[model samples]
Target: MNSVSYDAAQRITLGMKASDCRFIMDEWLHRDAPCTLTVRRAKTKGLLCVVADINPNENPDGLYFLSWCVQHLNSRVKVDIKRL
Candidate 1:
């Protein structure tokens, strides 16, 4: 399985506030947090991931969006690619 590197993870972030997300990543990377990468399959929708932190109290469209960091993301690549 292929996984996302720290460099790439640094580039990927979620939430409207980049600073907030950056802070979270920084904590995980620098502070040695037990950050985990996770992935969820959405039946026919392919996949669903919380790439950012939204208002959990205020469920927009009846969907509660909580804050998510790279820790909760799946770095492994589960797809097959062909060279052109």
Candidate 2:
């Protein structure tokens, strides 16, 4: 299994819509990887914390996909890969 974590220093206040978040999760689910997406509220008001656990055996491209997501969403809100 492989784990990836994404965190934003500030709350995603720009054009980040709920649909965008859902779309990412939906796309992930549609992939071959057996995975789970977890979002948690941070102590800071606007901070975003997201964690994904995926079966590497099932999806070798999981990391690349996640990195792409980060870049794609960067325009809306800045998210960094905290862990890999």
Candidate 3:
């Protein structure tokens, strides 16, 4: 994808919004590659949060982690891919 599209995609996959996007972006870029991402959309608060964990023996690609998370959730809770 192009740079803007790629960044937009990443923002969606990261569950970032305009308010706190800078902090999230900073944290995401500061993280080294070969990381795993955890995306949570809380039912109670109706908030979406993304956390990246860098550990061995886990799926190392960010996109892979996103796919895995979607599979794991099994659409029980909605993952908003179109946001951002």
Candidate 4:
């Protein structure tokens, strides 16, 4: 399958520490490395692949990426829409 586009994917820039998560949307969010988010076909909740992290260049779009992690799954992770 093709990789999911930023728009198709749920922005997840909420409440996540910029230091922890790297933004990749131009000035919207900076990243040391582009995050590769993969969709899980699990019968249960799916998880994201948080492979590597980078550094930020500009402000984040608030929403970073979708909740691929189980911890964030089905939960409200806070982040600035402007950052995503």
Number of the top candidate by lDDT? 2
1 or 3: which has the higher lDDT? 3
Per-candidate TM equals 0.25, 0.47, 0.34, 0.21
Query: Compared with the true structure, what per-residue lDDT tens digits does model 1 show for residues 1-84?
Result: 432232222212222233434454565556443334223332434333213222223323111111233334333212221111
In angstroms, the error of model 4 at 26 is 24
Model 4, which residues run further than 4 Å from truth?
A: 1-12, 16-65, 69-71
Among all candidates shown, the one with the greatest TM-score: 2
lDDT: worst 10-residue window of model 3: 1-10
lDDT of 4 by residue, 1-84 (tens): 223234433333333333323332232233432353322222223322232221233322222333342144344333222212
Instruction: Give residue 46's lDDT in candidate 4 (0 to 100).
Output: 35
TM-score for candidate 4, residues paired by index: 0.21
In the range 1-84, model 2's lDDT, one tens digit per residue, is 322433312122122345566767677777754345566654456545555554445553655666666677766644543233
For model 3, what is the alpha-carbon lDDT of residue 9?
Answer: 33
lDDT per model, in order? Answer: 0.31, 0.51, 0.44, 0.31
Candidate 1 segments whose C-alpha is farther than 4 A from its true place? 1-16, 37-84
lDDT for each residue of candidate 3 in 1-84, tens digit (9 for 90 to 100)? 312123333333444343343444455456563454455654446456665433223343665544454454554433344423
Global local distance difference test of model 2: 0.51
Off by over 4 Å in 2: 1-17, 42-48, 53-60
Candidate 4, position 63, lDDT: 22
